[model samples]
Structures are given as structure tokens and as C-alpha cells.
Target chain A: MSEPTSQPATQLPSRDAANWAKPVDGLKVGAISPEATNLNVEGKQLSGPLAGFGQMWQKTYRIRLSGADVTPEQVIKLWKENFPQFWPKGNRFFGGVGIEPGQVAVLNLAGPGGLNAPGGGPLISTGIMVIYADDESFSFMTPQGHMFAGMITFSAERAAETTCAQVQALVRASDPIYEIGFRLGLLKEEDRFWKYTLTALADFFGVHGAEPDLKIVLVDPKVQWAQAKNVWHNSAVRTGLYTLAAPVRWIRRLAK
Target chain B: MAPVKLDITTRKINAKTSILDIRGEVTGSAESILMAAYAEATAAGAQAIILNFGGLEYMNSSGIGLLVTMLIRIQREKQRLLAFGLSDHYRQIFDLTQLDKAIGIHPTEAAALAAAG
Candidate 1:
């Protein structure tokens, strides 16, 4: 095998600098204080869709704003500015430093294991890294131990001479346990999550009563058993343990 | 900014490997073309595939996600994937997004092919 070449940074061809994020040792969540119990995000490695253990899926949720008197750029800008407002209830998105590259957004989601809802669990605290952002689109990559190991992109474009807003997610369950959740109700719940989000987004532009068009594709059906060990970093379990140990940490802090 | 478009050319180098000569920007709009190219490579029954990124200019986060999907698909088929000619920026991107851990990154197609061999 040929040896890997080590080219100096200057020797590389020029690229659009603004399109990528600066290299980081680990994730650094910014100034936005998280409202949820955050435990699984700090210092975690960013995980792409390939890192997950479950079958891969591509899901798209789109809505047309034909007569809303808004351009694609306008829609994207507004969407970025008021992003958290569009999320479903029982979920909180803390947009730290406003969706720019290299930033992190903390998320608190209600579910069975984390939130401890009547039928559900406890609140799951996780985060996503803003890997790329532009005028028309932005995408977030999940961290290790997150529910879904993957990326989600939100973009706006002109379709059929009318403005369209879309959210495309390529993801897989981060671990085997979550894969079980995905096979049960997590997948449908996710579908509902994005559908409600898009509806609210369309409603923001005065396009009331617009239904989101949904598309789901199974990119790969084979489960990655080798990645089953990812369960060790499972955010739900980690967050729960962190919550249980909060008083211990508080006492330690007082002693310090 | 110019509208980003993707052009993919698949060439089988041997019975075991094929190279995907991808040119232009890989963004959200390039999804269909990338997926189709990957499908063609898989259908050709090549055991390993090398992605030539020498002509690639820009690839946003969504494009990275697509590559991740491709990685999963290739793995499901029990095939291997190698990539070459990514600029320093994208090399950093690969590491940042942990894609480098999933796919081999080489400085040249020749090196990638050698590694595949």
C-alpha cells in the first residue's frame, strides 16, 4: 500500500472556506444556556450517520409556500432566526450562538427512558453540532451517544415556481437499544416530530393549514452488529445516571 | 455564488474495484446523482469502490451525510470504499464529522487503489 501523503496546509487546493467548520478536539457548546438537563454533549465526538448501529434511513419532510409572498432566502433566514419556536412541545432546542458552523445546540426531548412521562421515561439531554451553514441551508450532526447518529439538513428552495422548505434527515439508531426503540414507536414519533415542526414553520409564514409532504426511504436494511458496543455511550442511560448523581456533584462542588 | 451541480462518472478499473470520478459541488442538490452513481457502482458488482474527489470543489454537511449513507450501503453489501483528492478543508471535515473513521482517505487515487489492493 502507498504511504499516506502529508501535504502542508498551504499545498492544498483552495476551497470555499466558509462552507466548513474549523477542526476541534471535541464539541464546544456555546453561550446559549441549555434549559434541559445537559449531560451527553460536552467533549463528545461528532458522529455521522455511518457511525450508527442500526439500519440507515432517509426521511424528508417538505412543505410548499406557494402564495406566501416569501422568497426561499427569506424563509430560510426566518426559519433560522426562529428555529426553536417551531419545535414540538415536550422538546426544547437551545440554539447556542445561532446555528453557525462549529456551534452546538442542546436538546431536551421527552420520551420513555429519560423523561419518565406517564407512559414515557425521563428527559433525554443531547446535543448536535452545526457542521455546515449557508444562506439557503444548514445542517446539524449528532454527537456520540445521541439517539440518532447522523445529520439533518434544513433547506429552502424554489420548486415549481413556488418556494419550498424542506428538512432532510439521514440517520440511524446510535446503538442496539435505540434500534429496538426505533423499531417500536420511535420512528413514527420522529415522523410526527418533524411533521409538526414543518407545520409550525409554514404557519409562521402566514401559510396556515399547509400539510407537509413526507417521504421515507430505507437506505440500508442490514443492521451493523459491530457497532452494537455503541450502547455504552447511550445518552438516555448516561443522562439518567447523571441525573441520579446530581446531588453528589452538588455536594462535591460545595466541598470544593 | 454559482449554482452547485454534480457530475458523476463510474469506471470499473477491474473486476474487484471501480472508481467514481465525481466532479462539481456536492450539496443538497447533488443527492440524487450521488445515490444513482453509488447504485450503479454496486450493480456493477465491484467488491471495492474508490471515490475520486480530485475534481470535487465543495461538499456541504448534507453531502457528508449522503456519504455516510453510502458507507452504510456499501458495508451492507460487504464492499469497501476509499476516497482520494479531498482538499485540506474537507480532510478536516472528514475528521470532524468522523467520516474518516468510516472511509479510508488518501491523497491520490493511485494510493487509494493500492490500499484497496
Candidate 2:
């Protein structure tokens, strides 16, 4: 287990650290380059007397997706129209069955703001990365929500003629609530955005596993994947720790 | 003073327990929505409360703390709190933190209501 002052992985294995919880090793991402993201946010459900605090979030979503065929402008439009739930006014934009990015929607975004958040529920700074174009992509900021700082970066390297892999990473410093969402899987709305973008790209690019919500298709070799999936997955996306090790029951079954 | 969006729905399935559909974030002033619901249920002398967690996407530490308070209130009222319609991963939180021992969490609204009755 991590000592009260020290981190886990730097000292103890993740498994051991999680079981004991003194701040096991911190999960680390590779030394990947991150670009700034621009995004707009609209805080949700704060109606009536509370509206004046302007607890509402307003901002645009920003991401820099780099690849041979992947243009930032095209991706933003597709995202706004297709997987808008992760963006502004989510409920109105996407199918009512799903959360739409909306005319200007936010997440469960319930907190009012801490001292940093405009009036004091939660504080947020939202933006996105700009590739070559400089002015495009949808993103914004808010007084409440995770993404204390949001920067979506997508860079591509030539992996193959038809299959150029991409890596997109968002650097978000989240509030404890946003952090807890990841621990609780309450951020399925956010996770869906990552899944939709990759699936849409795969469909457009004719790669393997065109499904939107599958677990391993983006990283699998069968498809023409994004060059930067890193932005799509990171601590910014989550604040707490998660584990993949099977439970003791599953481990015992495997032994059998 | 912040406005608390209060949304409550009740379906009478049996005499012992009832299901309360809650939408919106259960944080800040919004927490009163639950407190009122809990009071009303106990006043009605219901046996249990099956709080439908379908619309609630996330809960902050404050929100979680509020829930803990609700559990305490229910215990004081000689009533039970049965949470239902939770996602599997969320259900795991109850296990990971051992909250299931403190509160009754079920797979769906139906299961919660059944347990309440």
C-alpha cells in the first residue's frame, strides 16, 4: 500500500494498493503531447431562484484530431450532430432516449460551484485543441462540472496508407464529483462520446468493428483507428482509481 | 438562495412500500427534495422507500453524504431504504464500499418495490 504521503505504483502494485487504499500508486499516462481544446458548457437543472447565480454552464467543445483524412472541422460537425450528448444542450440534440449535446446542454452538472466555479458550486475551465486550421471545433467552460481544465488533443502518425492510427487525449482536472463519476460509472454520457467518435470514424474509414459501444474495437488491429485515442481516455476523463482485475469469485472460477 | 428543482413521482404498487422516481442532481438545495419525500413516506407510514435512481447520472461526495443521511433518517423512522434501477458498475460501488450492508440496493424498480413490500 502507498504510504500516507507517497503514491502507489511508484512503490506498491496497483492490486495491493487498491485493496488497502492509502493512495496506491497513481495511474499514469504516457508522455503524450496535449493540445488545447475549446468548449462551451451549459449547467443543468438549476431553475428559478437559483438561476441568477447563473449556475448555468456555457462553453464550446474543443478537440484537435490529426490524421491524413481526419479534419478537425469535419469531426466537430459530426460530433455536434451525432454524439451531441457530451457537448452543449445534450438532451435536445441527441435522441430524447439518449442525452443530446442540446441547444446548450451540460452533464448531470448539478453542483453549484466551489469558490472557483463562477458562483460557487464547482469550478471549470473548458477549451479544445486547434490543429492546423486554428478556428473551428466546438467547446466551452463552466462554473460546475469535471474538466477543471479541458484540452482535447488529437495527433496522427503514418501507420499505414489506409490505416492511420490516431490518439486523442483530453487533459481535464476534475472536481471530486466528476472524479467520483468515473469511480461510479456515472460518466457513461462522457464515455459514450469517445465510443461514438471512434465508431463514426471507423464507419467512415471502413475499418474493423464499426460498433459504437464495444470495449476493444478502437485499439484492435482490425480497424483503421484514430491516431490519438489517448485524449479519448485519461485521468481527465476520470479522477478516481479503477481496476480490471477479476474478483476473487472470477479468479476462483478461472482456476477451476 | 438557490432554486432546488424538485421532481417526484409515486406509484402505488402495494400497501407496504412505494417507489419514488427522482430526476435531477441530488446536491445542494436539491437535497431537500429527498428529505421531503422521506418525511412524506414515513408520515404515510409506509414500510419502505425504493428510491428510483434512473435519472440520477452522478452524485458528488455531498450527494453521497446526503444519501447517507437519508439512510439514517429511514432507520430512525423504523423504515427501510431500498435503492433500485442502478447500473451494474454503480452496484459495484455499493460492494466496493460495502454500502449494500447499510442500504438495500436492487437491480430494478420492480425488484426494489418487491423488497419494500
* Candidate number achieving the greatest DockQ relative to the actual structure: 1
- Please give the lDDT score for candidate 2: 0.38
- Roughly what TM-score does model 2 have, to 2 decimal places? 0.32
Candidate 1 residue spans exceeding 4 A from truth = A1-15, A34-36, A112-122, A244-256, B1-4, B35-45
> Cα lDDT for residue A69, model 1?
87
True contacts kept of each: 0.46, 0.00
Docking class of 2: incorrect
The lDDT for every candidate, in the order shown, is 0.81, 0.38
DockQ of 2: 0.01
Task: Please list the residue runs of candidate 2 whose C-alpha ends up more than 4 Å from where it truly belongs after superposition.
Answer: A1-256, B1-6
Question: How large is the i-RMS for each model, in angstroms?
Answer: 5.0, 20.1
Model 1, range A111-193, lDDT digits (tens) per residue?
53224433232468788888888888888889889999888999988877889999999998999999999998899888888
Which number leads on TM-score? 1
TM-score of each: 0.87, 0.32
